[model samples]
Target: MTTSPLSWLPLPSSTDRAEDEPASESDDQALDPVQLAALHRGRDAGEAAAAWVRSLSGRQENEDHALALEHAAAGIERASHQEVIPGGEGQLAEELRYALGADVLLGATHTGTVPDLAAGERMPLVAVCALAAAMPSCVLGDLPRELTLLAAELDAATAAGRAATTATGLAG
Candidate 1:
């Protein structure tokens, strides 16, 4: 008796959604060249960081983890502020920027409704580095190599970002 407009429509099947919808919501947006390049950089940075972490020899000593994190934050901040790009910052960039500034890895804990392969391996590690590089109280209990891996990952990500910006003609 309470049937409104919702009652008449049939539920969509998986196949219907698979054929009509994009794999992720970000795919629906019309990204310009700059945004596209920046996204590419973000993806690659994640991959590169993951690779670096996977290849690390062992835990880092009590060297200057704070300095490493500070450098990474500075690099990410600079990229976020790049004015040459016109379309504005994309989701990935903003997330990375915030995580870097906060010295935390929000992506590691984020559970999104949509699955994104572009962020499959790299993003998690990228966030890990954001937290690890700082050697905060929570992270102090982690392994030394884990901290090392985080630093290496951040370094790789920053380098990847630089390469991407240069390729996109957005480097200054």
Candidate 2:
């Protein structure tokens, strides 16, 4: 019999544990402040975007596009639940950053400036763009079609934002 290299690793038991069994205390102790904050922000952003997408899906001019958006929203919601696993917080943060950027662009395009967004509410959107700018160049071809479209949309928004700031003499 051949043994796989991963066979030595501990596997989770399929048997159910008693309800009285104590949970591991290490779970809460594992995360640092930054990671915890990222997880929270990612969860909140995912929930808000999912709700927004659900509402937007109802008003779509194209049924196919609406369906795609609904699926995307569900995927985002599922990713949000990954916070309990190791390294899942970072994954959620990255996914929400791209998703939120696309959401911001869509909302801004459909409706003019959202004057109602509080600073806290607006922070994730701003952070998405800022992080994108700081990161290495993206190869859109490597991403899935949906994400490619979202990235393109965000790129256009970045250009528009720059132009608006320049026109307002806010660019230094």
Candidate 3:
């Protein structure tokens, strides 16, 4: 049999996949503080929003649900515009408005009514759909990778805002 061009390289050993191994020195180095903080903010938000969505998964939609969703969406919009960071580095904030807005539209389409969802349940749905819309603009325009990160971060923030609004115990 003819050798494939890829055959010269060795395959990864099982040891490479070991999670118990200690981190390498290079891996120990800290990431940029700003980026780390931004990531935390995004992840916290996403987790919170996801949790809120879960909490309401079995509940019936009501007037309270409608109000809450609208409030959460509005809060996310406000935060997106107001939470500015230095050097315009608030990447999460920059993309949230667009994502949140698309989320509202998408949520409405899927749910048949925006008010049918709990406040915290609506945004993540829309945010996920918005990803396809946002990514192409960045990739096709040859935008910096940072912009894409920011867009993703914004999605996280939207989730957090929703969770914070709907969850009983968390402040997000």
Candidate 4:
């Protein structure tokens, strides 16, 4: 079996994973690992965003994706680079945000099969912030302090994931 070197990142707690949710190969088709990490990292962002939205009178309980979520994420990120991400997030947009973010969280939370960078590797904070800036929301996005907090949380989550995997010696 070709193990990804990313195994060091902690697998999400059972509480974090949606059990009773059927497996949908969905975005598994187009994913190449990096995007997945981004989605995994982004999941926390989504949760945070959802809380923010709820405070603003929005309520949404997320659904497990039934199809192509990661490919959609990469496509959307690509689109953002190609053109200016538009302003305003409607309900559809929030859902899309959740999907992409969840995948990023999945991606960011693990990285084991590689024989390349060892277990403790992390995507730099600057890169994380850059990615966040590219999100469709910056125009109406929270202030700098809030953005910084998000980046810090991502760093912490990634570190926690890595620590979990390393502690088990199954990371690499």
Candidate topping lDDT: 3
lDDT of 4 by residue, 130-164 (tens): 34435433324442333345445644544553454
Superposed model 1: Cα runs more than 4 Å off: 1-25, 57-128, 131-172
Clashing pairs in 2: none
Ranking by TM-score: 2, 3, 4, 1
- Per-residue lDDT value at 101 in model 4: 50
Candidate 1 lDDT by residue in tens digits, 27-141: 3445445434433333334345433332221122222332333434443433322211222221234444454543322222233222111233235435545533232221233
Candidate 3 residue lDDT tens string, 54-102: 3443242554444444534443433322232222323333454553454
Residue 162 of model 2: what lDDT? 41
Q: On a 0 to 100 scale, what is the lDDT of residue 123 in model 3?
A: 52
State which candidate, 1 or 2, has the greater TM-score.
Answer: 2
Query: Estimated TM-score per prediction?
Result: 0.27, 0.35, 0.31, 0.30
Query: At residue 48, what lDDT does model 1 achieve?
Result: 53
Which candidate wins on TM-score? 2
Worst 10 residues of 1 by lDDT: 1-10
Backbone clashes for every candidate come to 2, 0, 3, 27
Give candidate 2's whole-model lDDT.
Answer: 0.39
Candidate 2 residues 1-172, lDDT tens each? 1211111222254123344554543334444444344334443444554554454455555555455446545644544423223322223345545543555424434443332222332343353343333221121222223233333443443344444444554333
* Candidate 4 local lDDT, residue 98: 47
